[model samples]
Every structure is written in C-alpha cells, then in structure tokens.
Target: MNTAAQPPVGEKVRCLACGEVFDASISVCPVCGASGEWLALYVPETNAFRRESEEIFLIVGGGIAAVSAAEAIRERNRLCSIVLFSEEAVLPYNRPMLTKAMFDSLAEEALAIHPRSWYEEHGIYLMLSKRVVSLLPEERELVTDDGAHFHYDKCILATGASCFIPPIEGTGLAGVVAIRSVTDAAAAARRAEAGQNAVVIGGGVLGLEAAWALKKAGCHVTVLENSPRLMMRNLDAAASALLQAAVEESGVAVVYSAQTDKINGTETVESVTLRDGTVLPADLVVVSCGVRANTALAQSAGIETGRAVVVDEHMETNLRGVYACGDCAEFRGVNRAVWPVAAEMGACAGANAAGEAAVYAEHPVPFTF
Candidate 1:
C-alpha cells in the first residue's frame, strides 16, 4: 500500500451531536439519539456476530467498487483480517479524478480514499501493485503474480474492464492514448501538451471527459463518434442533444456518425480518416470508445464467463467459494457498468466471499439530472 494514499491522521470519530466518545454500532447518535450520515455498513454472514468475524480476502481491480465493498465488509467483520490486493501501484484512490489529473496535478492526498496508514489502523493487509493470477475455487486457494499462494474461505473478482480497441488501419500508431486509469491519465497528460490539436474517438462519458481534459490543456479538441448521438446508450436523444449543446458551448467540435477508416501519420497519430473521405486533423488522438469486461484472467482459471464473468444476483459465480462483481461480472444480464451497481455488487460479493450468505439487489439507473 502507498503510505501517501491513506486517510488523514487523527480524524476524530465523534457523534454528530453531543460529541460523545461513543464505541458502539448504533445508527443513531449515542448521545443525541439522532440518525446522522454515519456510514457503517455490515454483513452478518462473514461477521462474528456476538463474538468476532471470519477472516476474509478481497482481491480488487482498479475502481471504486472494490473500495466500497471492502469498507462495508471491514465495518461489519472487524475481527476478519482483510487482505486487500490491487494490480495498480497506487493504493485505493478516487479513480474518477483521473480525468481531472490528466490536465492538472490533483493532489495525491485529495485523490486517495484511504492512505496506507488508514489501512494499517484498520488492520487490513494491503498488497499494492499485486495481481491475482489464478483462482482455485475448488481448493479455496489463489496465486499471485509472484507465484505466492493464499487460501480463502471465499474470493471476489473485481477485475473491472479493459480499454476497448477497435481494429482499424494505423491504429497502432503512437500518440494514440487511452484514458482508463490514473496511470493512463498521467501518461496522456505528459504526451499531450498545450497548443496541440487533439482528436478524440468515442462520444461516451469517458470520451467527453478526455475532451475536457484536452481543452483544459489548451488544445483544440474535436470529438468524433461512430454513433449518431452522444451517450446514446445512457441517455435519450433529448438528453443527448442537451449534453451535446452544453459541450459544444465549451468549444468542443462534434462530428456525428463518423465511421473511422484509419489513422494518418507516418510515425505517430497526426490525423483520423473517416469512411466518408473526410479527414480530421490532429496532433494526438485519445480513444475512450468503451470498455470490455476484463475476463481473460478468469477464463484462464477456468471460471465461467458470459459477456462477462457470469454471476448471480448474490454475486456468486457458478463455482462455489468464488464470486465476481464490478465491471467484470454480469448479474442476470444486468450490465449497468457505472458506480452504483458496481459498488453494490462488489460489496455484496466481498461480504459473501467470507463464508456468509449475502444476496445482492438490482441497482437503479443513473438519474437524468
């Protein structure tokens, strides 16, 4: 775990009112008897109940879902020794801030969800920059990138997604960037500079975000979409129109239904060629078209996979003692790969992975606000 990513030291845990030194799991303030916004989530299956909790291991991919799930499980099963592992070098940080970090150096402290110290204080064993390579669901064992093995009463797969790259001529050209994680953001920010002209592929949320970052970098940004409208999957035509107008107001150029044929550049991406014989000039290109579930690792381990890792509403896979969630898992064909569903799915999977019966609920759609 990165020590810099931990929570602030000596953050007082006081009741909302009366300011009592309370030490009980009461939703209402112990002294004031008022229910304030104190988020202490729990799962009874893995928890010790009247005694202690069952020790569990949580394997996370890059995203907030795993973090949310880990917190929920940690609060309830205080006795459980949680081993938090991430493939990313950084500890659990606010991943959404990656877009902002692309153009500006967002403080590391501000991005971190819990610093290394916070995990230590909470008694969680943090394995930063570690990857879980194999899952032995039958033996309840798992292997890491270094061939280290650990047995779990249960396991979770929050492997998230991979950057979707469409096959096109000259797609391999350099300066073709993808913004999926903090590492990607940092790299893009360095590659992209002010006064550069950037062409962005995809009209999804991430594409728009990348355009914003590029604009802030003083680049003239143009967005090219294969779809007829932006955010077609998430929003209706009316909402898309409003969002398009709002983004256009920000000085972003939008090209609708652009079928890209190839990238143009001898050594690096200098422009994009469309199927209609139109060329969009650029100094750099960023792709945020969409994401596909990262199920290769799971597939290698012989776990069942559908469009994604096939899991039930409870986040359980076909195999016992193994669970999947977040962007990687498909629950009853529900693939709302946003924060809310991923968080709920990951939390449910983590709690149940500790030898407890935990069922997940269907998440709601994002509100059109």
Candidate 2:
C-alpha cells in the first residue's frame, strides 16, 4: 500500500508514467500500477553545479511539468524559494493513470507523484487548492482566486490542458462525463455497472483506454469514431485495422464513421443518437475528445499564443523572466501534449529560469498502447 511516508532511500526505481520513485523491490508502481517494464533505475542527481541564488521561482499547475520544473530548479539552486500552486486539493499526481487504473482505489497517497516529505525536505512550498486567476507580467505578481497575491522573480507556467468536449446535447447529464481527473475517473467507475451499456465517443487512444476500462468492469462497451478508422491521426490504415481487430476481439464494439448527434436522457445519460439516426443505448457516456491547451492566463497576460503559448527553444515566452511548458506551451508551431515532451520542456524552462542555458530540441513524440 502506498502511504504519505517517503519510500526507502537507495536503489530505487521511478515510474515513467507518473514519476513516482519507490523501492526497486516493488514489481508494479504503487502509485499508477504501471508494470515493472516502465520502471527505470532512479539515480539521485548531485548538486555539483549548484549556484546559490535568492531569486524566487514560481510554478503554476500541479502536473508532471510543474514537479519537473521544481526539481530542475532545486538541482541548480538549493537556497532559492520555489512556490508551486495547484488548483487540485490533493498533491501533484500521475494523471495518465486516471483511465488506466480507473478501478483502483486511487486515494491521494496512491496517486501522489512524490511523498509529501520530499517537498518538505526540499523546502518546496506547495499551495494546494489555490487557483491563480491573474498574471501580471509587469509587476511580477500573481493573484489567486481567493484575493491572495504573490510575487516572483521568475515564473514557469505549466498550466497543462483540459479535455475538449465537443458540442453535444445532454452532456450536463449525470452519467455523461469526460475522464480528466481522479474525480472524473472515480465517477466513471461508479457508473460502470456490470451488464450495463457504456458508450464512448471518439476512437482515439484515450477513448479506447476508457472503453477497455469500462469493459473490464463488466460493462458492454461500444466505441464511436467519427473518422473512417481508429486513431486516424496516429495510426495508418494497416495499423488501425490491426488495432480494430484486436479491440473487437476483446468484446468491445467499434463503429467507424459514427458521428454523434446528441446524448439522449433527462437527468442521466440513457442513450446516444448518431447523426445517421442510429441510437445506441448507454447507461453511461464517456467523451474522449482531444484536449485544448490552457493558454487563457498566458494570453491575458499579453503573451504570444497561437494554438498554445508560443515559446522559443529555451521554453521562454516573448516576455523576459517568464516561461511556459507542458501541454500549455507550443514550440515551433507544435505542441505534443505527451508526458516525455512535457518533462523535457519543463527541464529546459526550469534550467533557463535558474540562470542556466538550456535548449529544448524537437523530436518525434512516441505513443504506446
């Protein structure tokens, strides 16, 4: 069982999915349940290049990018004050596991990216459940929703992204939802009753994962894809065909070129109506549309933004002393909102924010089943 206590030091492994470090003896990640194959030997970084400074580093968001930025900042400067603000009530967690381990008892401790002791020991002040409402680049100040203001010398924005919900009727119903946070996952799991019908809109990787999770919970699952094939953006025709075959073999129904018209129900989801007039009964509906980068805060602060907050190779925005990374940032007109890219971008942003030169090189983002 995962707890708030720190893991034993020495010879540990880190979960690539959630960046949770634990004893190497553990076969599966206690936090995300990722297999041992995803574990890597954890080697603690030495502060050999430490440069003492009093500059305050403020990181906004509670995702892996925020945590990575904090770690990078600490590596180069030990005495610098690092303040992390997360809107979530719980500590930063492994977000990708929400659908992958939907049925697991994902208490705060189990989902935490690192034990609370790590932050305490590193002197990283965590302001949980605090939403930064405004950013004043000129004043180097930020205002939270509670009217509290904070000042920083340098700031990193890892505000991440939110799940995009396409316009569809009846989405406000109780059983119709999207899997984004732990709370969403828990709600979906509760609705995944055995022998009940669950309809998933979108045939992307996330939609498939959610479908499989509901199927594992004994729900009759059906996936709807507006495109002619599954994972159209990621998989070619041959690969998509192979994946569809495998998915259908697992007892989940797949419908191609299925455009949803609306969700049908009163207070709870009862069924989904397709544009072709086909109705699929659904006790629960999960929307797996793509995500949109959370760039409103950056844009409102007069930062350049196209699809997301535009940044240079160093992950620095147009404004000096300000940087953006993770899903909320775009480099060279591309923003691959993946874990590896976010981590790399955060490291570069943090390093540059700490008076060190760092460059983020563009690379092909990899996706796995």
Q: Candidate 1's error at 208, in angstroms?
A: 1.0
Q: Least lDDT summed over 10 consecutive residues: which range in candidate 2?
A: 360-369
Report clash pairs, candidate 2.
none
After aligning candidate 2 to the native by TM-score, how far in Å is the CA of 224 from where it should be? 0.5
Runs with alpha carbons beyond 4 Å of true place in candidate 1: 1-58, 367-369
Q: Candidate 2 lDDT (Cα, whole model)? A: 0.88
lDDT per residue (tens digit) for residues 207-237 in model 2: 9999999999999999999999888887899
Q: Report RMSD (Å) for each prediction in the order shown.
A: 7.7, 3.4
Q: Which candidate has the highest TM-score of all?
A: 2
Model 1 TM-score? Answer: 0.82
Candidate 1, 1-369: lDDT as tens digits: 655443244333444332322223334432223454642322233445232567666565646667656666676667876776788888776565677456756456556656668778777777878998887767777788999988876577888887888887876788887877777787778777888889988877778888987988889999998888888887899999999999999998989998888999999888899999998887888887778998987898788898899998678888876788988999887666655567678778866765456678674454311
> What lDDT, from 0 to 1, does candidate 1 have?
0.73
Count of backbone clashes for each model?
A: 6, 0
